[model samples]
Target: MEKTWWKESVVYQVYPRSFMDSNGDGIGDLKGILLKLDYLQELGVDVIWLSPVYKSPNDDNGYDISDYQSIMTEFGTMDDFNRLLSAVHERGMKIMMDLVVNHTSDEHPWFLASRSSVDDPKRDYYIWRPGKDGKEPNNWESVFKGSAWKYDEGTDEYYLHLFSQKQPDLNWENPQLREEIYSMMKWWLDKGVDGFRMDVINFLSKDQRYMDGNILDGKQHGDGSPYFLNGPRIHEFLQEVNQRVLSDYDVMTVGEMPGVSPDDAVLYTGEDRGELHMVFQFEHMDIGGGPEGKWNNEKWDLSDLKGILSKWQYRLEEVGWNSLYWNNHDQPRVVSRFGDDGEYRVESAKMLAACLHMLKGTPYIYQGEELGMTNIAFESIEEYRDIETMNSYEELVNTYGWPKEKMMAAIHARSRDNARTPMQWNDGRNAGFTTGTPWIGVNANYPEINAEKAYNDHQSIFHFYKKLIQLRKQHDIIVYGRFDLLCPDDEQIFAYTRTLGEEKVLVLCNFKGQEATLTIPTELHSLKATLLIGNYEQEESDTVSSEPLRPYECRVYLLK
Candidate 1:
């Protein structure tokens, strides 16, 4: 195993829209981010992974890019962005832009030109295919719930969109498109960006044959995802990308791969020869998405999640590096998802940080996650704004014949908007996100949970994260130590150990409400550490015993 610089660095993810608003236009902007440099410095992060701020039609938020070169006017001019880059570097933090080239807004110049006429020079820039049997080119369905191929009357062909129809898939098969994307990436690199977080990057290479999938049991389409996720020629395209732009820059790239397996991840992030530095895998996040399409139907036993993460941690440790994270712009707050938000919100939030940060991999912290934010509780469906959530909500009620109350329950459980709501800055009416009406409502608890409050509280989750980050940077073991599951078969205990030459850490977590004893392993007999951190009242002596641990108590014991 090689050294992981990312594991030693504290990464902060910025959802650009909700970060800051300088123009008073009720939206966050680059200038707004520039103004917050001091704030970020105070939080003590090594890198900031900014979400997309590219010129777009605002479909699927900013994930749909219309122009790669120009920054959205709403976000401020490119000059403002350049100043932000300089300012961030001045504060000793690197910047990583979100790369959304897997798909582009239909309004992108290439897509617009491609849609005008089939014979147009730019027609190959996007995936445009003639309808098969006068129907869609395949039995694939869009992630937004419709035929993947949309009829384009002007071109007399259908344009493929894995996500929204507004966002058409780019044809990676075309050398010209690949060259263009590489060029844009280099342009950002030249401007001094540290790296990129590729969005749904696995979605670029589609099944070459355009094969109609087998009809699902009582369902219309197969997980058409198989067609677009990690398709043929993906490695070739990634190698080309690395050779063209990434290889030349001292950059760190983390691909947002939704459906990739461990073997594929090895290819994408292996230490010996991989396309990216690391990748954000979806296995852990999907635990809450549930097996069915029902939004609020997410259910996970603590033991099951423990097994899932343990397997990934073990399997990927050998082949590739992992991008460790709990929350991002696309998912709900971590405390709400994995912890009992009502009773153990703050403690478990810090505990979750302790659990993940101790892993031998890179760790990413979403904006406000350090402050222990919880999920939003919207009163009406109209209050929701995310396109994905809105579409699913409407489907459950109007199209699928689900009761409104039942659908609302689902929406609360799995809606992406639960995470996309404006950042809650204060106790103001709009949560201080905007002086005027915000584009979306902030969680009402912002008053108590804002950064201001946390800055004052010494034992706040925010401060705990700051401490954990410092420890990760100073200690080599936390970064390179091999991991071992201490209690794999326990139904409620998620315990593990990270070992270096002579140092060791014992991490124990009791997931449920009842008190349970953690039977300390004999191998951990060398440790004589006091309780470094725990989610509950830790009853640790100078030396841990082979005693069962208490409930919801996650303790980290350092070697004395």
Candidate 2:
């Protein structure tokens, strides 16, 4: 496989609104990020991926961009952004901005012009179609719930918005719009921004047929994802992006692609594809969801998680690269989702980190994940702040007549707001995130899980993550090594090996809360090994043994 800096580096994602609050504005700003530069540097991350900070109405929490060039007032001014960029570069770390070109805020100038009238020149800048028999243009449902097409009386036509009405999908078929996006990307690159995390990039191209999707929940409209996700023109548009703007700069780019398969991922990230450095696939994230979608209360099988991750690991080993992550701004906390977040939070967090970091990809750590933050339990629906969560709640409760307790249970397990709670810095009021009223309530368990406590504790999850990052920099095998999974059928343990030349490293992770025996293969049992790093501080024998691993224990050994 080809080598790249991004492949060898670890990325840290920060949701600016939840990261920190400065000036007591009840919101996190760019200057607050500047104040935490030393914190990130100490964590040893190579790249920082900042969520959307562009000018927005905050309808979808900055995903609905009103201006590509201006910074959101809630996030401070353009000067603050410039200083933050310079500070990150001076600290020897790269900063990546969120690129939400798949859609723009309805308040955006382009959308304002496109919605003026049917005959307007900018009308073609967005997807607009006449209603079909007094209904929507097609039987498509928005991701946030409801018809995908919204009727505009001014133009007497319908516009497509896959997410929310406030976020109108852009017309990628329009050459002028594509040029505008590329030009904006170049402007940021020229301003010293390192790269971009393109949001829902696969949804940029549509089928154009506007066919009705299969009805699933007996709702009038159906999920329109199949027609838009990874559409026919996705490759062409991405190649255009690569050739026009990305080719000129040596910056990393990772596309947020949902519903992408391993076969398609090869084309997207192939060494010569000229598309993206890597793509974030959601197969593993969707393992726990059922036919009803992510909010469904279903148990996730450990083997299923192993199968999904291993498939991508093996498929992309040679053809392309992978982007390994468990949590992000859009997903719930990892410890709560995958591991035992109650009694074994610290150990399971370290084990989960070791499992993904040992894979052949760039590891991404979401904000507060290094401290083993778990999902929050809001007492009532009013405490929820995510548009997606609120919409789903209303639909499930009022439309379907589902019990309020059941819907709230789903929200507790899957709401994006679970990840949007303020960063717990200390055990002070509002978790020391802000002196004033926080936009969202801080997690009530902040006293036990704050960063100040973790930093002071030598054996905390934060220090384990620091060691993992240090290991990646110290050993080249961790970056370019070939990966091989061992005991693939084991439901309780995850074991893998990374080999580069004569050097090899063995990684073992126990996913359960009971003692699990790791039987070494007979052929490899005699080899001598040295303990490289582990969550527990112990010197085991020099060779493999039939000893049982403790609950959520993670150990890495250097094979000789």
Q: Which one is best on lDDT?
A: 2
Clashes of 1: 7
- Which TM-score value belongs to model 1? 0.96
> Candidates' lDDT values, in order?
0.80, 0.91
Best by TM-score: 2
Model 2: per-residue Cα lDDT over 285-359, one tens digit each: 987787658989698777888888989989999989999999998899999998989999999999999999988
Worst 10 residues of 2 by lDDT: 537-546
CA RMSD per model (angstroms): 1.9, 1.0
| Candidate 2 collision pairs | none
